[model samples]
Target: MELTDLRKMRGKQIAVTNGLILTLLTIYFVMISVLDVTFSVLFLILGISILIQAILGFLKSDSTKSFIPIFEQVANYEKQKMGREWNKQRRMGFIWNLILSGLMFMQYYFSRGSTDHVFQIDFTFMFVITLIALGLINISLFLHIRKVDRSTSELDMKGYTWKSSLVAVVVGVVLAVASIAFIMFYILSNL
Candidate 1:
């Protein structure tokens, strides 16, 4: 494929993936609304971010200026480099979605009998598992980007550093511990 064709292909990949995510998020938001559940601010932030991404994805796919910075960088690459990294780029989004689905499945399986709202569905366990899953996903993305950086000369991308990964780990652990402690305090105080 020509360089322009390769860029278009990448743009389409991004658009399709973002579109799927937007659909799923819309479903989730609707479900929570129907159930009268109070959602975290995180969901609002994520929803807005996904909405922006979907719009940017569509623009990129239309061969317009890519609002996403990464795609703009990728556009500078030669067709050969772009082609070589295409498979990895395509797979990364799918793998991330799969991993998240798996985590959600595990959470559902463990909390199956509860008819409670989503928040009370063994959330502490799910929260910790989610933290771990996100960490692993981040590491995987870091490695993928690092590999791509090694081959491409057009982009001077800095992949995730070990220190950043370590910091992420530390923060996740701290959050998990704090959440657990808060849950414990709530239970004990009620008793």
Candidate 2:
């Protein structure tokens, strides 16, 4: 493979790993909240790392020549139209993360102070399961991005093979869902 191809592959791998880490941290947050577990700062660091990786991935993708012209054109037109809305969405994501983190910390403090408080066992279990499902969805998205990157690389080297990319996407999504379901069930049963 060419150096550029390798770089793209590496970036895709990093992005996927970051996505998995983000999903796991989100699941941890939900589990802690529902079960009244103590909040760990480590999850905050992980979440931040995920966000950093996501930004890095986006920047790296944009650095490629293929996307630059299109991005420039979009920027020129959107700057006068939807730029503020786009910025708002970005700000909202950051704000939501901050709020969630703060809430988790507050919950931890409260739970720590009141050991006698009864936690809802069923709801805790359900929350964890649902978070796992959401994690799987994110993982599926990451895998899809990776598959598309790899397919594009392969096409550049070995000519077009439409079926390969399609198959990769399908398999990646299937595995992501199956893994999530298995993990959720296992965690629920054990809890």
Candidate 3:
């Protein structure tokens, strides 16, 4: 496919994914708000940041200008490298998700003490549903990346940057750390 075609497809995917992410964020915010306002707000900010990044990715120009041809070349090289790495990382993520799902299921099953303290059905249902949604999202992202990798040459001509992936990794790590910290704090406060 042509660069324009690939760009259009990616743009559409980004928009749809961003919309779903926003919806999930809304649900998460509601659930957390019931538990703790502080933790909820922290997650709300993170979700908003993700939404903004997704919007930027979707709106980024695909056209290459003569004035910055060298920059474009560098970006193309980086995208190619990042694409290969991303493919490998995503394969691992898929496997990990499957393992995690199995573990969570087992934990839920084995932790049941009695009917009196039976896991809250609502929480259990939501937990499973959320895990499924996350798994699906990751799978969708993996497929999208695969499609993009197949069309990388076409996209490279348009000056797509692979450095974005590196940046995303750093930002994702920071956000994850912050999320873990917040969860810990929330748990401690409640206890």
The candidate maximizing TM-score is 3
TM-score of 1: 0.35
lDDT of 2 by residue, 1-191 (tens): 45575466546555655566667757765665566542344344445565565455455442323343443433343233333443443344455455555655555555554445333345665566567656765666465445434453332323122344466468768977987887678778877
CA lDDT scores, all candidates in order: 0.51, 0.51, 0.50
lDDT score of residue 4 within candidate 3: 78
- Tens-place lDDT per residue, model 3, 1-191, is 45675566556555666577768756864656464434334433554554454454334433222244443443354345455443444344444444444544454455444233222224544555566556656665666466555653543433233454465568668867976786577558757
Steric collisions counted per model: 0, 0, 0
What digit string (tens of lDDT, one per residue) describes model 1 on residues 99-179? 444554555555555555545444454455555655665565455445544654424323323434466569768978987
Candidate 3 backbone clash number: 0
Q: What are the per-model C-alpha RMSD values against the true structure? A: 11.1, 12.3, 14.4
TM-score of each: 0.35, 0.31, 0.35
Model 3 superposed RMSD (Cα) = 14.4
